[model samples]
Structure formats: structure tokens, C-alpha cells
Target: MTMKRIAPLIVSLMAALVAVLVVGRPEHADAKADANPGAKDVIVHLFEWPWASIASECTNVLGPKGFGGVQVSPPQEHVVLPGAGYPWWQDYQPVSYQLQTRRGDRAAFATMVSTCHAAGVKIYVDAVINHMAGGASTGAGSAGSTYNHYSYPAVPFGNDGFHHCGRNGNDDIANWGDRWEIQNCELVDLSDLRTEAEYVRGKLVAYLNDLISLGVDGFRVDAAKHMPVADLQNIYSRLNGNPYIFQETIEGGAGEPSPSEYTGIGDVTEFRYGDVVGNAFRDGNLSGLQNLPSQMLLASGDAVAFIDNHDTQRNGRAKLTYKDGTNYALSEAFMLAYPYGTPAVMSSFTFSNPEAGPPASSNGTTNAVNCSSGWACEHRWRTTANMVGFHNAAYGTGLSNWWSNGGNQIAFGRGANAYAVFNRGGTLNRTFSTSLPAGTYCDVANGDISGNTCTGTAYTVNSSGQFTANVPANGMVALHINARTTGGVTTPPTGCGTVAVTFASSTTTVWGENVFVLGNRAELSSWNTSGGVALSSATYPVWRGTVDLPANTAVEYKYVKKNGSSVTWESGGNRTINTGSACTLTVNDTWRS
Candidate 1:
């Protein structure tokens, strides 16, 4: 459950029916692929991290680690419960769609998205749309919008906006087993929005589209199970573009609106997969993880996998977590190395009390995240970070040359591209066959390659394509074609993936006047009007340039027709282009909208 603190039992209801997604079914289906078209396939859940911190992390840790995307905490304005020590769950109680919160203002959020996307890291905002503030409180929201139990002025939602489940103005879901009541009733004291109302659906879709326009790659539909699937299909159908959408339909066991019911819309978080991976790692059972509980879940292509989310970590239901130390790392390594479903790594702030808020600044707003400051930052750990790269290098390839010591130990190759081994129990010597063509390789799990030198243990595979090595207890070792230094079947690391920019100008241009792209991004021109990358007018009407940029990047550039000393800039908002997972992508856009 993404929301916990205040009402554990209510979240319990959420955690039960936790995840769902689908694609390749029909027009209703989102594409049958990972969120980001060609991303690393590893999405990190940076829970409650401040915007600037998230930006810094995207550039330094996450981008370099090859993480495809970041699932940031909800960015919408919400309740600020200082009276309750400002519980973290308070943010989950959204008061309005205003992009203002303890994290940052609307501008900060937009910058964070562009920055992360520029670094090849997609941003998936946690969208808490199922309900608003739970208790019957009368106060101004974080964005200074006044709100009550049945009224929210920021979104201008009134009495007609909420569901009338009837209980002294509160409609608590007394019976979770009843699908209708669960969907229509209030979760705790929270006022459930009447999503069936056209006004409500429009407002919600508009808010989501605003984020998409701001450049977010996708969304985590918080408490999606609480809303009717039909309402969801309508809302998503009307989105600007197919942004990555995964829902939180937490009715765990087989029951009403099975995960398949939501599959036609977007990817679903397979909570059961988390339980399986967590338990297997915690208990050192490699075989149990081989066959997942796919009977009642969506297909691998439709599922978002995670080891332990916010709620499961706090509620003691997860098998491994930051508290578990080595076991947690081992489990995460397994999650990435194994090709089960789209993985989401949880990077939460360290908290002693479940209800405790983030480290606040002097103004009581969430402080700038300092990983050293009680934040788990699990996504930055050596094992997890390197595994992200391993996953990237290995994705699009299926498992081969699979080897297991029958139970607690296992080693597998992602075709011939990657090979990883995990020794959950007491380990020493073991030999495994791999598709790799016999060569010395660097063990990225221990230390990555620098220059062309290996910083850690180097394993040499014989001509027979077999390597014998001793793995540590509860240790993980991963080596992929993308991690190799010198020889072998390694593909040189494509650093700072590039994107192609083609500008088609509608403006009148003379023989001497040439169109050039310039922007605040260094790749564009460092905002220098004169030094902007000149576009080729091979085809008089269109100008183009293949610009090298960081993967998953966003650039705000404008086309300017330059004749030498003088320049005519496009008179409009800066045109933006967000790059994807490809080594190089093409952005065909007009000069100015």
C-alpha cells in the first residue's frame, strides 16, 4: 500500500488487491511493452524525495546506473498534517491537483521531470486520485486552497463531487469483500470522489494531462481498485498521449475485477511477485522463484514487479527491506537479474516511526534529500545500482544456460549478453556453463570498470565457455556484455545516448538565413543564440541535426533563422523534445507551435 501511517487497516485493504496492467489486447490496451519504449526497464521508486535531490540523483546516480525511470512520490498538493507530526501519509491525502507540496512547487516539479528525462530517466508521478482528505477537517491545503470533508475549492469539487455512502457524511468501506462498496465507499474517513461524474473525470484527466505536458513519462494510479474500471478506461482514453500508466488495485486474492479487468488499460503492480521474490531471497530458495503465482495475475508484459513497496515494508509483510541488510540487497539483485516483470526498486527515506514525516527544513517543508540523512537510498547501493545496469544490458534477451545448485544457488545468462550468479547460502566453489565466448570479464557487482581496467575480481572463462568461481555467502555477482572492459563479446558502453532533432520551419527564410537550434541545455547551445547547433537545410523546408544527449533527456530549444550578425528567434514558448531509451532517437518537430 502506498498510503499507511494514519489507518493501517484501511491500507491493509489496499495492500490486499495491490497491482494490475494489460496491453496488446485492443485499442483499449496500452502498448505491450515496458513503460518507457526502450528504457533500461528498471524503475526506481524514490519515495518522498525532494525535487532538487531527485534532480541531482537523476544526473549522478540513476542515469549512470542505467535506471530507465523514477517513480517519484505524489507531486500534487495535499494535506499538511503538522498536528500529527506531519505524517508522510498526509501527502497521500491529496487536497487538490495543484502541483505544490512539501517536495516543491509546480516549477520545481517540471524542472525535475525535464532533468530526469534528459538523463534517460523517465518520471512516473504517484497519482493519488482515489480520494481526498479522510478526516472531517476544515483547513487550507498545502496550496492554500481551503477544504472540508465534502468540499475542495482548489479543484472546485463540492458536495456533488463526493460519493454518498452514508455514515454521518462518512462512507467507510465496512465490507472490503463487497466490490461495489469498496469502489463506491470512503476509504477510512477520506471523501471518495464520485469518479462516475463527468466533471470529476474531466478534472482528473486534465490534471494528469498537465503532468504529461510537463513531460512526465507515466503514473502510478494510487488506489485504482477503488474506482470502476469503466471510469478508468474513459479517463485514460482521453489522455494527450499514452503515458506509462500502472494502477494500484489492491484486492490481492482472486476476486472481483481480477487484474485482467484492468489489464486493457495499463501495467499493474504484481504484488504477489514481490512476495515471491522477497520470500525466496529471505529463505535462500532459488527454485521457488522459478514459477511465480501467474494463475491469478497479469502476464509478465502487463505487470510491474517490486520486492517491497512503502506499505508492505512498514506493515512487516515483506520478506526483505533496508532493515534486512544483506538479505534485502540479495533480493533486489535477484529482482533485477531475473527477467520476471518490469521491476520497480523502492528507495524510501529511513524512518523509525511509520507515521513520521520526511526530514523537514526550517519551514517544516520536506528538506532537500541527503542520502546521508536517514534516507535509505537503496537505489544507490552498490549491488542494486550495478544490477540496474546488468538488467539494462540483459533485457530483450531471455534466460539461457540456466544453472542452479538444485536449491539455494543459481546462475543464468541472458542469452549471451549477460551472466549473473547468486549464492544465497554458504558458498565457495562452483562452475557454471555460459553462452559467453571464453574471456576475462569484470564482476560489476564488486566494482565496475574504469578506463579499460577492472577494479574488482576478474573471472576468466575457458575456451569451453565455462567459469569456476567462489561466491560469498549471501553474495551476488553480475557481469554483462555492456560491462566488459577490453575484449570478449562486449559492446562498448554507449554513454550519454543521443537524440536526433529535425526542425521543419514554416517561416520565410532567404538564401543566407539558416535555421539553428538553441536552448538552455548545453547539448543545444548553452542558450547561446550564436553558438546554437546549425541545422542542415538539405531539404529547403526542413532543417535537421543529430544531437548527442543524455539518455531519457528533455531539451527546450527554439529554432532561429540566422544570417550572421542578426538572428530572428521563434516568437513562442520553447519547443521541447524528450528523448527515449534508444541509443539515438529522432524528434521531428516544427520550429514553433
Candidate 2:
């Protein structure tokens, strides 16, 4: 949880709560081993999803899609603000450690974890242990737990169990560089818990053990950056079974506490990964991502990699999201396709209004997710879900056969087990050398393997270990040894080096107006508007096309609109584009409408 709070309500006192168990799982039961699942794990954060929907996705979607696990939102009872439309961040304001949340009750959560585990998928709870609801009186909590700045009867934490925030009139993390202030101070007036106290730690331990008993495999420690690392070590050391724990310690630049401070305690979130990946692809610089800077997160083995998370995606630090369209999807493809850290898929609901909660009832209890109800089920996209299989197939293999067009165009193989080619800034019609046993394999990028048939394109690896294809602009293709089409494998004949060059453009036109692109080159119909290739308006206000063109040629072009006998030419200088020396290139532009 980042420290940014939406709004606040007056806090009150704790109410009668249930007694928590002190002991953890039985002695013989392991915490570490039990929490960590097997290899090729790709954890998807089902942000704010209801427990029932998560269960259904595990059986009908996650299991079949090869997702290793899910990182669910914080399930603790929290403050309910009808006035705020029940912002999703409300989950972070813990009123109690109880697992009953607006998403579902305790029974629902238990069922979800069990169901997911049964389907070979683990459940990682997002543990918000740092603080409680803000304010000092009159709290309105979801689970009916009454809480004040120092009184949470649900956990029965009183004045002594929390920090004296207003004692000397402290500021809300006024200086991020000051470690003491960051740890002890209240975040946006949220009551900071006394994790340093043994009493609080015991309650937290019991809560976590309870979750483990309910079949939770691990936890994502929220706002860990705001808590003491030593205290965290203490809490983990007292646990019964080793639950996989990854702390949410966002590296907010140099002045913030180094994420390394909490590294030995558990796996940490590497926020730098997304920003770097986004910038590289956005700027058409592929090689930049491969060579990470020292300041960036490079300990891939011990870090969690993602294109964006809830906070960064909403707060503008994350460079890409569903809103970015093609580039957004491209980031995920590139991340998963690369042999780096464990990848996480972001599955979130759509909201033009950032503070709005998930699809919910009038009371803010989230309704079951149905994709059509304003949720972006990105994990279900063929491009994302299918890549999980490829990531699994290529696990533990070292990167080999690295090749690049010295620009954004690149291709590489995973030790002959799999191959991937990427093209941005234009098209990619280049061949790369490989060492695979010649055979036909499904291009997992286009689609998944349905039994013996590849739902995508089929490519044959030549006897000499070479792959040839023309990836369209903002497109890519992938193949793995494990995903070979039944008869897709074959020996390649001689002469396999050329790739298709696709010329493309985008423009906005009013209704009834069609856009056409023509240029001063043979590929552009020799600048003849009537003979020019027709652009598709299937995506209204935008047009695109892929055309076969001679490689290594420079051309000038412009867009023209036609409707019956009427015609409109873009009023501007002739646009110039280049076909790279390689077999592919892309000319991207917008009409000067």
C-alpha cells in the first residue's frame, strides 16, 4: 500500500471481537516449503476481485491457462465509506485482522484458497499489517469493527499498542529520506500500528497463521517500506510454516529507504522494472532493457517483475497500462518472453474515475466479475494467458542466439528450447540463426495450442536452425520446443532469409470519410491515389494497413480521404519513412486532419 489516502472518517473504539489462536501450524508442517510453489510460477494480482470469481477463474481459467498463483487484495475488514463510493484503496485501511471483507466473508475466502490450490494454483494474500483506519473517533467499518486511533477492539489494540503520532505534532512522512519518520509517522493520518510491540506482533502472527490454516500459500506484505525491517524479521521467524512472503517495498527513488533493507526478509517488489521496460519499448530502444543500470532492480531471481501495479498504474509512476493499447500489451509480452524474474499479470477493473471501487452493489460489496462489467480481464487475453505456457516451457533455460537489428527489432532463443522475435517502430521480416532440432512449432504469440492444432500461425525450423517471419508493426511471434504442432515441424528448404516489410499509418476521419495512404514509391502505388492500398476503418477514427514493400528504400507519403466522387488530401509536407536494411520496416504516422 502506497501512503496516498483518498479520504478519512472519524475513528472510534474497538468492539467485542473473537479470540485469536496463538500457535501456528503443527510442528511437522513446514511454513517455507508449504508457501513456495513449484517452478514456472506466474502470479496474477486479481485486484479487488470477489472470492467466488477468483475461485471460478482458478478452475475454469487460471488452471487451464497455466497461471501459477494469484495475489488477492487485502482481505481484512476495513473502513466502509459510502460517501467515497468505496474506493478500492479502502482494503488497505485495516480495522481488524479478520478475513471477512466486502469482497467476501471468511467462508468465501477459505473456499477460494482451497479451490485454487486444488487446481494447482496457490493464493497469496495481500497482508496490510502496517496501519489501521485513520482518525481518532466515530469509525464506520465494513465488518462492523469499531476502531479509534489507538483502539481497535477487533484486535483489541488500545493506546499502548500504537505509536503516539500526535504526541509532538509529527508530519505525514514529511521527509521520505528520514527513515525514522517514514517508519513511525502516520501515513495520510492512517493510524500507524506498533509492530515494534510484542503484543501487536502476536496478533498479527495469529492472523497470518489463521490464513495459512485456510490454505493461503503466501502473503504480499503491504506497505512494508513503512515498517521496521527488523520487526518484520521477528514476525517471520516466529511463524510455524514458511509461507512465501514478498514485501511491498516500493523503491521511490534514491532518497527512499533502499528496498535492499528488507531483501533478506522476503522477496520485494521491484518498481523500477516497469518504468525501465516501458521507456525502452516506448522509445524504440530494445537493447536498453537488456542492459539494466546499477540503480535499477537487476537481482531478477529475488524480485517480482510487473509492467504495472495498482498504485503505480494509478499514480502515474508506471509507464504503461491498458489505456496505452498496443504498447501496453507489448510490455507484458516482452517481459514474459524475456528470461528474467517471475512475472506478474495485472487483472484489474476499468475505471475512468480512479477512486471508484470494483463492480459492486450499492453498499460497495463487489459483484462477481463478468469481464463485460467494466473489468479488464487482461490475463485472459490470448497474448497474455498464452505466454504463461511459453514462460513455463522455457523456465530455467539460459538465453541463447541473441540477435538484434541494432534497434528496436530483436530476436532471441531460450537455449534452443524456444525462440521469440519482436518488432516495434515498424515491421520485422528478418531471419535469425538458432540451434533447435528442425521442426514445425506453433507461434504461441498469435494463439495457444488447442490439442494438436496451433490456434496461431505455424512456422517450420529449417535443418540449419533458422526461423523466418514478418512480424507486423507492434507485433511479435514466439515458438517453443514443447509447443510443436503435431506435424508442424519440418526440414527447411534452401533460401530462408527474407521477412515481409509492412507499411502502416493511422488517422482520424469523421463519419463517411475514408482515409487512403499513397507515397512516391512503387510500394505506394507510385503516388496514384486511385491505385493506393485502401486503409481499414474497421477501427473508426483510426486507420491501418500492412503492405508488401521493397526493403532498403526511402519513400515520401501522405494520407488522402475519399468518399464517392469527393476527395481530401492532407495539407502538409510529404511524410518520409524508411524501410530498414533488414527484411522489414514500419512507417507509422497520423493524418494531418
Candidate 3:
């Protein structure tokens, strides 16, 4: 049989295996291999760590901690705010996509990528693609690329590449209610690119593809909600077809674009989490914690969850701050223990003030991340790192037998492999159902288990699935079915015998549903379908017109948009098509690429 004919059968068999695991009550089963592409549980947001240091951290710290990946600072060259003491926000501005920056030169960055990938830790680049540097006049970026927004001679980005200020003007972003104006207009005097244009898309793709070629796994699209949803979709389609695109849409309250707009295309940062955790911790209301797992269950699986990010740490008032020290550690520990949207824990250094930069050299380069300089390497905290391992081990599991007092104590089992509890109330004793095979397990938060026994405060689960333990005031506890005295499962899942493919692109307009048409005579050869048979496209390269996809089976696909020949793929390698969406001759891949 041809490759096309056999591909569907392979996918079908895999899907069936996954279904049985998801629905059947199997004993001590591991996570399904193809569960979620980026669903390894713990992700470390290595704020402001230079590339070289990050590469080492991934190898020595993150890899051993069982973290799925690391979200690095913006890798692109940005404006250097010397007056601000090279504050972290300086990197938020972009002059060009040169690999040369404070993080390290191109060579250093390449080494970081290769080194991290070798250790099984994926690198998610913080891509500031929405706008250029906020205040740039010298045309020369830190990477030595000369770029004047008016000229941008080094990048050859002339007036044609940018969007002109609207009638409202550059600083009028707060006044303009339309998303187009927010995206197209200059953000705080920054240079805004016209992502809809073909020439612009090509340049952005060239930069992103370069990173992908260097082994970068995905992107955290900065200021995503500022751009049009359609535009982002188009850009994503053109770039690396379905590369990991996580949009930074700060949806704080009710009046913002729902993560749904971007969820169809790629994972989006769920900013509400900061507020949820902040309010819960500050108010000392553990009942507030009860709502979290349920809320996360409602979130799309691709949602990127975080307790505190760089922006929140600097701007949000009620949000968790590094200054809080121990409180921050406790909050992060709870975040990791609870299964939510894919979690990316914040790691930071000490700063006297919010505007302070990382420990820096007189020459202006960012210093290494250190705890002694008052930097709170929250990831290094025992509870935090142990939870990271717990998350990895509980990867495809759902919350079962959840127990919460509607106050300071909460506990739940992740699948059957792990169980955890948090005590925010004053010290107390309680008996709860753990659902573990009646045996002794180490409380991972205190210490790990060893040789059928736990080291520190080992708890025994009676035949009734009840275990008694005391949760000290402002403390936490965890017990894993399988973990060593000093370790838990540290390996991420590698799917069974399937080669993965990803798409990288600059803008979403080219292959967006709104842009392409059936009669437009678009070339659709770069796209392919996996679950069933026969996939075709119309004018839009990203649109998968119709196919005979298998019922209740998962599929993966990629697209190549026409703007200077850009290619994009799904964030994860697969998406399940429920039986309701499948038919004999027609099934639509409407869940974006």
C-alpha cells in the first residue's frame, strides 16, 4: 500500500489505544504517548537569563527537575535602555531579528538551542513580533543591525513595511477601541509592522525559520491580543506552518478577547490565572483554590497557564511578587501540584525595585541568575521542583476524587499515580481518600519514596483509601505512587513511532480563512492530512477544505502559505476529530492548523 493509505491505519490504531487509556480504568497506567504536544506539565519561565546560562540551566537544573520546557526572554535584538539600567523591558523592544544581543551572540544562541534540545528540554522563544523598539532613532540595533524605522537600512524595511499612524496618533492606543488600531498603530512609540503585507510576512518568516533551524521548538507571541486574530492566524500559517504559537493576550477581566479567538490556532497565555492565585493567596482564602481545577478543566488543553509572568511581576499590584519570598514559593508550589493549563513557573532574581534589571555588569550585559543576590530562584525551592516532577508524572491524568474543605485544605489525585494536598489554614489533622493501592508512599513535598518505603513522614493508605496526615499552617504535602526518595519521573513522553512535524510562520493573514478563496487558484500542494485519507485546500493554503477523516481519530497537518513561500504547521502534531465531526466524504479541519 502507498504511504498515504497506510498512514491513516497507523493513526487509527494509535487513536484506539489512547481512547482505551482515557476511558478505561487501567491499573497504574502511564500517560498516553501522543496526549498533548506541549503537555509535559512544568515549564520554567527563565526571565532575563542569558542564552549561555539558560542553556546550562536547562541541562543541569530544568532537565533534572522534570520541566517540560523553558520560556526564554525575547531572543530578538531590542533597544538598550541604558537610562533604565537595561531594565528587563528593554528587551521588549525590537530593532531587528539579529541573534546578537545581551543574551549572547548568534553562536552562543545556537549552542543553547542544540544543548537544550539534546537534554530533551524544549526552548520557547519570547518573540516580540508585534512591534519594533519603542524609541529607536539610530537605526542600529544591539546586534549591530542598523535599522531606522523611517529607513531601517540594515533590514531594508522601508516605509512600505510598516503601518502608518492612524488619525488617533501613536500614543492613542488607550483611546482606540478597535483591535486593528491597537495592532497597526505604534505601541508606545514603537514601530508597528503591517503583518498583512506579503513582503513583511516573508521577512518575519526568515527570522523565525532561522530560529527553528537552530532547534527552537516554539514561540510565546508577545502582545498577541494587540494584533487582529485573523492577522495572527495568517502569520502562523505562513511561518513554520503549525509551530508552537502562544499568544500573550492579557485577559485580566471580562472585557477582553476570550482566549478562544487564538485557541483555535495555537495555545494562548491565560492571564486570569495571576489574578486568581493572587486573590486567593492575599485573601488567605483556600476555598478560592477549589475553583481553580474546575476553571482549568474548562480551559482549552492548549492554554498556557502561569501564576506570575514578567509583565505581571512588574505591573500587577495584587499579583505575586518576588519580594514576598516564602509566600511566593508556597503559591508556586500549589500551582504546580494542581493540574491546570500547561504550567510555566516564573523564575527571577532579586531586585530592590520593580524596574531593576538582572544582576548586571558595568558594561550593561545581564548577569547570571543567582539566588544569593536576593534573586528568588523559585524553581529551586524544594516544594516547587518536586511539584514539577509530580506534574510530569501525572501528565495525561485528570483530577479524580477531589477533596477540598472550602477553606485552607485541598487534595486531589492526578489519575492514580499522584495525590497532593495544600494547607493554608492553621495546622490541622485530617483523613482523606488517596485512591492509591493500599501501601506506604512518601510525601513528595517533604521527601521522595525509596524501595517500597518513603523517607520523610511516609503515610500509609488504609484499605479504605483513607490516609491521615497533619498539614502545618501555610504548608503543603504530596504523595506519588511511583517516586524515589530524591526523585520522581523526570522523562517527558516521546510518542510511539511517529515522526512529528511543525509549522513556523510570521503572520496569519496569508493562509487565514478570511484571506483564501476556492476560485483564487491558490497552490495547495504544501499541505497534508494524517488521520484518514485525501486532504485538499482552496485559495487559503492553511484551510483544509474537506476530507474523509476517520471517526473518533486524531489527525495532524501542515500548510505552506503563498507569501514568499512560508510554511506553518499545528502547534502540536495532532488534534482529535470526534465522531460527530466526521463523515464518509467530508470532515473539516476547522480547529486551525
Selected candidate, larger TM-score, 1 vs 2: 1
Which candidate order results from sorting by TM-score in descending order? 1, 2, 3
lDDT of 1: 0.73
- lDDT (tens digit, per residue) of candidate 2 on 150-225: 5666677666666765533743667767777888888877778788766677778778867765667678998999
lDDT tens per residue, model 1, 144-253: 87776766666665577778787434467776567788788877777788887666666787788778767676799988888888788777765643467898876454
Clashes of 1: 20
Ranked by lDDT, top first: 1, 2, 3
Cα deviation in Å at residue 303, candidate 1?
A: 0.6
Give me the candidate number with maximum TM-score.
1
Residue 192, candidate 2: Cα error in Å is 0.7
Backbone clashes, each candidate: 20, 15, 30
Number of the predicted model whose lDDT against the real structure is largest: 1
Determine which window of 10 residues in candidate 2 has minimal summed lDDT: 491-500
lDDT of each: 0.73, 0.72, 0.60
Task: Give the Cα-based TM-score of candidate 1 against the true structure.
Answer: 0.81
TM values, all candidates: 0.81, 0.77, 0.74
